[model samples]
Target: MEIDIKKHLTFPVFLICFLLIISLIFIFPALKMIVLGAILAYLIKPIAFKIQSKLKYSSVSIIIAMITVIIPLIVLVGYISYELYSVVSTIITSGSILDINQFISQCINYLHINVNPNELSQSVTSSFETIISYVMNYSVSIVSKFANLSLDLFILVCSVFYFVRDGDKCLKFIKSFIPDDSINFFDKTIEDIKNVLRSIFYGHFLTAIIIGIFGCIGYSILGYPFGAFLGVLTGILQLIPIFGPWPIYWTLFFIDVISGNYPRAVVVLLFGFFLSGVDMYIRPALSSHYADIHPLILLVGFLAGPLVYGIVGFIAGPLILGITYTVLDSYRKEYLMGDE
Candidate 1:
């Protein structure tokens, strides 16, 4: 007897079952790492493409791109991590924020300001002390868990290499699923995604570099010993929402003051002021704020992402929000705007 399998297994049924299986098998455990890999892949693929044209081997091209892109970043991150840990450890061991407190006292005393710099209640200091304890505890945990994190990072790197080399395959596979009527809509959505990624990777990162460059030049001119690393640290910290370059420079300013380097302290304060203004102008020029996703949205994402998703959340949270906002916005304009 001949069987008509098409009647028993429709396209939608097959698609649903296939997608469910795919999601169940891999999506849950590795989804976070994959997302990070996708971001790196998006940024590095163009360079890989350029190399691929000349090298005639995807593998060789991918290695060139990976080394070019990932190594320098690793170096920079390692420097920042080392410096921050060193500084924080020094402060905790020798343990005096008094230079800063003294400077603040002088400012309030001379400027006749209402700001009470010395008003940090014993209670407040103890609260901060408690927070520092938690951080120390977490650092120990981070050391213990390094193996797991390394494995995840390795998986992420492998994902990035394949993505840079064969990311087009993923795009093609996705495109295959789009219905004919939805082609135009799908293309527009893809453009929206491109725009959002541009804002995050190019706009945000370039702005950070600009701030970093300024820090480097300013600190070098003022004769700080670790100026380049300080600037880099400033730039990396710029990635966070509320924390800016002020904390680094201001601390340095206080250190200079305590060391009786009045000239350099003044210079540090000046650079701090100048770079603050530079950020206002330069960031807007670098990246487009897609769909005007509110700063509040970003602030929430920056704060909450880490709480929920560990370190990766800090980058992912704001980006995912922007993309989601654009998608919903487009749908509203197309389907809901007119109806209401």
Candidate 2:
């Protein structure tokens, strides 16, 4: 007896399948991390391949490349942490609070305004003390989280190794699963992803390094306190769109203002402004040239990524959008428009 397929499959079966997929997603979140690592490995494959060709050992080359990349990052973090601690210590010991209060009072007096400076000073000091206490308490939890993150880092490193070793075979296997008609489309999409990664690595990451180096050198030359910390802050902020460097620059400016070091502050501000403007030109030009994508698309992606996925969203957002556009264009040209 012949049976109808639709009669046997019902709404409940669909619901069960949906729930099962969702559960699997939660259980296998590591898949996302692996995918991220694979993308990173692909971007750095050229360097790994070169090293392997010279050394004749893929595993050793991969490990050496990973260490070469990771060591600088570790050193940067350690330096920044130490510099920030030094700044905090200096702020606690120096009479910065009193100087700031006096400067505020002088400004108010010059404006012909009458106010109780002593009361204002006391209130500000109390608030600052409370904030310091809260931050001290919070540091404990932050340290605990850092310790746990070590495990995640280990997983990420392992994933990077496997991705580098098997990346070519993996891509080939995945391509085999795609339909013959859509192979070209898939190839174009992969190329788009590579372009995006290249843009990110060259444009964003390299620009950040340049800015950080400039900041550190400039601040140190000008005898700015916590120069290293400010530089690192500036670099990290560069990762954020638009307002990233403003906070660090402004904080240093205000500190100078309160300390009666207006000349130094003005110089720092001018230097920062120049460096930041240069970054604007460098990032867009590099991104456009490498990715062959519109700068406007990148600008929009930078803004939209954080709104959609928080910090990591910036990278993910641009990548996903770029791939989508490439795939859709390929589909239109091949099947619908029949041009390519």
Candidate 3:
């Protein structure tokens, strides 16, 4: 006798299978853009709300928020990119690096390495040529990358708008599928995730800006022509975790000391070392009273995120890790501790 297939496929089972299929169809392909949209939504949410208070229109508020935030951000990025291009171009074009090469030779000799200066110079020249060629190729590919990035940005914007506007509905839809008793656990896990992401992203960004301000002052005082640019660059570097401000400031210090500017070198030394050390204190200072966010998650997210997930991996990586951590911790509390 032929069994009834429709009878076996109950409503709940069919719904589950349908949802699973839907996720498979849409989730992975759009995951990166979705993650980016979440970040933008979180960041601009306050602005969106504040504007909505006056306008009372969610769509208009989102539009205003995007303009307010994204416009300035684009301008700032453009400025920083131009400054970086100028600096790199100047360094590559300038032929007055005899002193720098000599300093390298001295350092090599200090290590007691049996290396020829001419060969070292030639190796350096070859490396520079390779870098130049790579840069040229990268420049050629940038247009296509920009187009792709732009499309991603548009999707992100639309996603952010929906997330901010219909977030409650979305959450309700998710929770509707959860068992009533487990809803509390699900919400707790989500709360933990938000706290972690917010703490890491906001704290790191604020810390970087603070360091950038200090760096700008120090660079300006040092009579550096690109003080503002370097200051901004230092801030961007602060997002890198451990080796943030030291490399730039120390290099500046070295150049000064080598040029007989001992006092200037000492000042840069003090500033760089101090600014570099601030990350340790700043991270904890910015974490929420209830949330003790560690730097390791953000660092790992930053370093390994891009490697695994491409550019969007930066946000997705940490988010995935953070959520995993929360889930495991909750499981331990609920299931493992139940034995006790």
For candidate 1, lDDT tens digit of each residue in 1-340?
1367767688899999999998878766777888889888888889988999998998989889989987888888788788877777777787557654666566566657886575743445678789989989998998999998898888898999988877888888998989987777777788787787787766667888888988988888888867888888788778776887888899898777766788888988988988888877766665555445666776787788888778888778877887788888888887689588
TM-score on alpha carbons, each prediction: 0.79, 0.79, 0.87
Sort the candidates on TM-score, descending order: 3, 2, 1
Tens digit per residue, CA lDDT, model 2, 1-340: 2367777678988998899899888746455455567766876677788899999999999998888778887998788778777777887799678776887687667556787888877888899889989988887777878955575566678888988999878889989979988888889878878887888767887888888788878887888766766777888888766665667877777767766789988987888787778788888887777676665666677788768654556777777776666667767877889854
Poorly placed runs, candidate 2 (over 4 Å): 1-27, 106-139, 142-148, 254-262, 292-311, 332-340
lDDT of 2: 0.77
Tell me model 1's lDDT, rounded to 2 decimals: 0.80
Q: CA lDDT of 172 in candidate 3?
A: 89
lDDT of 3 by residue, 78-154 (tens): 99889878877787688536755887676577567888877897788789789989988987887758977787777
Error of 2 at 239 (Å): 1.3
Candidate 3's error at 52, in angstroms?
Answer: 1.2
Instruction: State which candidate, 1 or 2, has the greater lDDT.
Output: 1
Q: Global CA lDDT of candidate 3, please?
A: 0.79
